[model samples]
Each structure stands twice: as C-alpha cells, then as structure tokens.
Target: MFDIDRWREIFQSINKNRLRSILSGFTVAFAILLFTLLFGIVSGLSNSFKSAFADDAQNAMFVRVWQTSKPYKGLQTGRTIQLKNDDFNYVKDEYESKIQYQSARIYKNFTLKYKNEANSYSVRAVHPDHQFLEKTMIDEGRYLNEKDLQEKSKVIVIGRLIKADLFGEKPALGKRINVNGSSYLVIGIFSDEGGDNEERLAYIPVTTAQMIYGNNDYISQINLGYNPDLNLDEAISFGKQLERDLRFKLNIHPDDQSALSVRNMAEANKNVGSFMAILYAIVILVGSGTLIAGIIGISNIMIFVIKERTKEFGIRKALGAQPLSIVWMVVQESVFITTIAGYLGLSLGTYLLSLIGDSLEEDYFIKDPSVSTGIVVGATVVLILSGLIAGYIPAKRAANIKPIEALRAD
Candidate 1:
C-alpha cells in the first residue's frame, strides 16, 4: 500500500539526524562497491586466461615425438623418436573418421630476404589442414591449399610481423621472398594479436620444408583438433592409442626417453577452470572482509539513531502506535538510506571498471572487468539484508522501552 504518512514520518526522522543517516548509508554503499569491483576483477582475470589459449581449437590435442624413458618390447630406450610422414599418414588413415582436423608441421628458424631487405625469423612447413589447427587469419591473398601441398609449390604465407618488417605496410601478396637462399612466392599474410608475425616468418608446404630444411621426411610436431562434442577422456584415450600405434609402426620404442609429448586443449581448459575457481575464492574472501567492516559501521550508526530517537518512539507509543509499526519505521529508514548510497557506490565502481577494462593487456592477469546482472542483483539483496539486520537490534530495543521512561529521558 502507498503510505504517504509513513514516508513523511521516515523522511522527517532522517532529516533530523542527517549526518548519522549519511554515515550509515555510506558504509553499506562502500561494501557493495568493493564487493562488486572484486567480482569484476576476478571475472576479468579468468576471461583473459581463456582468451590467451583461444588460438587453439577447443578440445584440440598436440602430439610430438621425443626420446623414450624405458625400453619398450625390443626397442632401445635411448633412441631418438621422430615423427615421420608415414606415421602421420597412418594416423590420418586409421583415425580419419574420429578426427576433426589434423596437420603435421616442420618448423625452424631461418633468415628470409627480399632483395637487400632481410630478416631472420622462424618458418613452419605445414599441410593444408594446418590452418584449421592454427586459427589463422589471412590479412591478404590466400592460405595454403591442398593443391599447394600436393604440388610442393614454393608458395608461402607470412605472419603480420614478418610482413610489416619485410614489406613496410606495402602489399606483400604475390611478392617473392628468398628463404635460406631459395625463392618462394608470398601467397598470404597471417594476422593475429599474439602470433607469429606473418611478415617476419614464412610458412610453406611441409614437403617443401623437408626439402629445404634438410629434414627430408622428418616433422617436428603434429597438431590435431577433435570434435568438442566428444568426451575429453575418450579423446585423450584415442590420442594415446594413436601415439602407441605410430610409435610401433615407426620402429620407435614406445617408452623412448623424450620420445613423444602430447598436449590437449581439454586438459588445459580444465586446469584453467581450476585456477579460476581459486582466484574467485580469493576475491570473495577479500570482498567479504570489506563487506563485514561496512556492515559493522552501519550497525553502529543504527544503534546511535535508535538512541537519539527514543523520545520520538515514546511519543508514538503514547499515541497508541503498535510495536511492529515502530519497528517498521526504523527498518524502512535504514533500508532506504543504505539502498541509495549503495547504488551510488555501485555506479561509481562500474564506471571505473568500464573506463580501464579495454586498455588491459594480456601480460597482466586482469582483462575486461565487468560485473554481471546477476551479481548486481545479488549485491543489492545483500545491501538490503545488511540494512535490515543493522536496524533490527535497535528497533527491538526501542519497541521494548516503556513509554513513560522514554518520555522522561533527556
């Protein structure tokens, strides 16, 4: 019900003790602001971590061969394990249906030149499907295609940094650059926030890389993207199986020391998730501490308000006002004051977060710090509860005071 009289009475009472009311309200407001800011910070940190690993496809896994730890079956332990072209072909053939995308890469650092302009940078030799695993973006021209791989064409794609260094903002596509003294045409430029600068590095067909780099049939690593819908555990099992089968077919010891390494995006996601949970827990602890201090301050101010309003309470009782009505009056005043002040603090906090969020870089843990609508609502509810609790004890004491005694008190 709309109670004009009740509002008027509450306003009059608050106006009589403006300083005390303001102080109490400020406490709740500060708590809400601090809590919300902490939540935003934690959320931002988690988001940044997730973004850093976004280049890799979800549920993707990487596999590379190294030396073995122990002798497996009849193979020697110290033998070096290398991934051969045949092994990659076997994996592709055996697990073609289960795989989403797969690519083998041979990478090395070499100096690239265009006329007299030369820069030493890393180069990768990859298959057509390598683009899928790389999350590559082509800034100009086109990426490697199946035809390029099959023909062992001297076509190359460069990273943005590579392009900028070699071509200086000029179009790099269709230009020929010499890598390790051999000329290759630039077919595309790869661009990303944090990736191999396409301008600085060159990418070529895996076969070409083998021919130029002297590796012949050797590959450094194989990257595979799995369907996200598949169970992570099952995917991991499938990867292990591929590893075992590849090692067996390659005449490499299964337990060859440093023989093989596998990295899975699903596992990374799980680890990141665990890290976020811990970060949020710390944020909550700190925010809760701040909230507790604010609540105590509000409670103290409410106690003072009750003491100052003893005479008013007595006068109301003398006029036959119910005990619950007196309680409601005090409780409403606390709620109104805290709610307004808390909202002001919340707005300020949000504004600050917005102003600085975009400028946040990857080097720092924090990123876009914005609280969700649910967090805002939850904070508002918490403020309301704090106000109610702060007013409760004082309101109860006022209600119990004998009208005669309160009226007599100076």
Candidate 2:
C-alpha cells in the first residue's frame, strides 16, 4: 500500500535524529564490510591453490630418481640412480590395475629452426599417454602415437608459444622443423593451462629421443595417472606402495627420498582440501560474529531510540494513533537504515575486491576475490530481519504503555 503520510513521518523522524540513525547504520555497515572482505579474500586464496595444481591431472604422479644420499646394502652414498625403460616397464606391468595412464620422460634441450626463425626450447620425449598426464590440449593436428614410438619417427609436438615464436602467423602443423641438426616433422600444435613455461616446451616420442640423442634406454622420469575411480586416500596409499616397491627393486635405501621418490598429486590434493575446509570454517565463524555484533548494536540503539520517543508515542496514542501503526513505523525505519547501510558496505567490499584482482597472486596467492550474489543477498536479508526484530520488541512494549505513564517517562 502507498502510505505517503507514513513515509513522510519516517523521513521526519530520521531527519530529527540524524546522528543516532548514522551511528546505528555505521555499526551495521562496518560489520558487513568486514564480513565481505574476509570471505572474498579466502575465496581468492582457494582459487590460487586450485590453479597452482591445474598444470597436471588431479590423479597424476611422478616417479623421479637422482644421486643416492644414503648407503644401501653394499652401495655407498652418492651412487647415481638412473631410471630406464626397464623401470618404466616394471611399473606399467606390475601396477597396471592401479594406473590409468603411464609415460616415460626423457628431457632434452634443443634448438628448433623453421626456415630462418630459430629458438632453443625445452624438449621432453615421452610416451603417448604423456598428453593426458600433463593435461596437454591438442590445438591442431595430433599428439604422438604408438607407431611413432615403434618406428622411431622423427616427429614432434610443439607448444602454442613455440609455434608463435618459430612459425609466426604461418601454420606449423605438418611442417618440418630442424631439431638440433636433424629435421623433424611437426605433428601437433598444443596449448596448456600450465602457462607460458609449459607452452614454450615440446614433446617427441621417447624412443626417438633415445635413438637419436643418446642411443640408450635411459629415461629422466616416470609419469603416471592413478585410476580416477580411487579416492584420495586409496590413491595416496597406492603411490606409497609403488614408491616402496620401486625403492626395493632398485636396491635403494627405503628412506632415501633422493634415490627414489614419487610425487603424488593425491596427497597434495588431500592437504589442500583439509586446509580449505579449515579456512572456510574460520571465515564462517568470524563473519557470523561480526553480523551478530551488528545485530546487537542495532538492537541496543533501537531500545534507546524507543525510550527517547516514549513521551511522543504516548501523545500520539492519546490523539488516537493505533499501537500497530507505531510498531510498524519503527520497524519500517529500522529496515530502511539497515538495508541502505548494508548495500553501501557490500558495494564497497566488492569494489575493493575488484581492485585487488591478481595484484596479490604473486606474493600472497590470492586471486579474483569476491563473494557470490546469493551469499550477499542472504546476508542483507539477515540484517533486515534483525532490524525488524530490534524495532518490533521495543516499539511494541512502548506502544502498549498507558498514555499517562508514557508521558511521565521523561
């Protein structure tokens, strides 16, 4: 209902007590502002963590070996540990059920030249399944196939940035690029969300690298994606078991991490999951506390305002004003102040978050911090309801007072 008279009265009351209204509104606004910033920052941090691991498949694991740090059986410290085709085959055959995708990696640094444009890029020779393990997206042409490995084909998959650098606007697929001194066909152009470093590298068949580069079965690392059906705990357990078996088979000390180690994405995921859970819980608590404080502050202010207006309320009652009208007026005024103040706080918080976009990513790992619309609306609704309650309780009591007694409230 359009009640102009009622609205006019509310405006008059607010105008008369500007300082009191501002104080009440300030409390609510400050609380909401704090709540918004806390949640937004935490959300950004969560995003950063997720993107940090985005380079590899969530189920991926890497087996890397280096020079031994501890003596084992008859072997002395500093013994060089090398992963070979045999070690890769052992994992593939033994843990076939536990593994989804498997690839052996051999690292190389080679200068790739297409016509006159040339640049040195990191090259990784890997099995076909390496594409999935690294989450590499084929933008054009196809990744390495089994035939390439068997035939030791001189073919390579270049990254998006590599193509840009070497081929410019020209198409790179099916073109021949000089690698080191040998000419290799470009089978694919790929992109990676892992960022520019990944996009500057290239991949070739593991056999091709072994045959041309070293003529040996030596591999740099073993990469595998655990079966996606397994839960984090199960995947982590499988990784640990595999690490132990590989260590025993290689005759390395069981505790020698440098000699044999498996970097499991599952363990990292679990730790991150736990950390986010705790972080969200803490934010909920602190946000809730701030809101409660706001509600309490408004409640106290409303009580005082009602006290100050008791004599006026009695005079109006004496002049035939209904008790419900008095209660409604106070409730309406409370809701208006809280609603406007809350909106201002929400807007300020959102604007601050937008300004902070990616600025904290490098140092603090907070990215794109902001609250969802539903949550902001929900919080606003809560504040409105709290204001209604704060006004109703005291106004109702004051409305029910006998006119003479209310007039004598002083």
* TM-score for each of the candidates: 0.78, 0.90
Off by over 4 Å in 2: 311-328, 362-365, 399-410
Best by TM-score: 2
Relative to the true structure, how large is the alpha-carbon lDDT of every model? Answer: 0.80, 0.90
Report the lDDT tens digits of candidate 2 across residue range 65-159: 99999998999999999999999999999999999999999999999999989989999999999999999999999999999999999999999
RMSD of every candidate to native, in Å, equals 4.4, 2.6
For candidate 2, give the lDDT of residue 116.
89
Top model number, lDDT: 2
**Model 1: per-residue Cα lDDT over 324-392, one tens digit each:** 998888888777877888898889889888987876544566878899999889878877897788777
| Runs in model 1 lying further than 4 Å from the true structure | 1-12, 15-23, 26-30, 33-37, 195-199, 211-215, 231-257, 285-331, 343-378, 384-410
| Residue 159 accuracy (lDDT) in model 2 | 98
Worst 10 residues of 2 by lDDT: 290-299
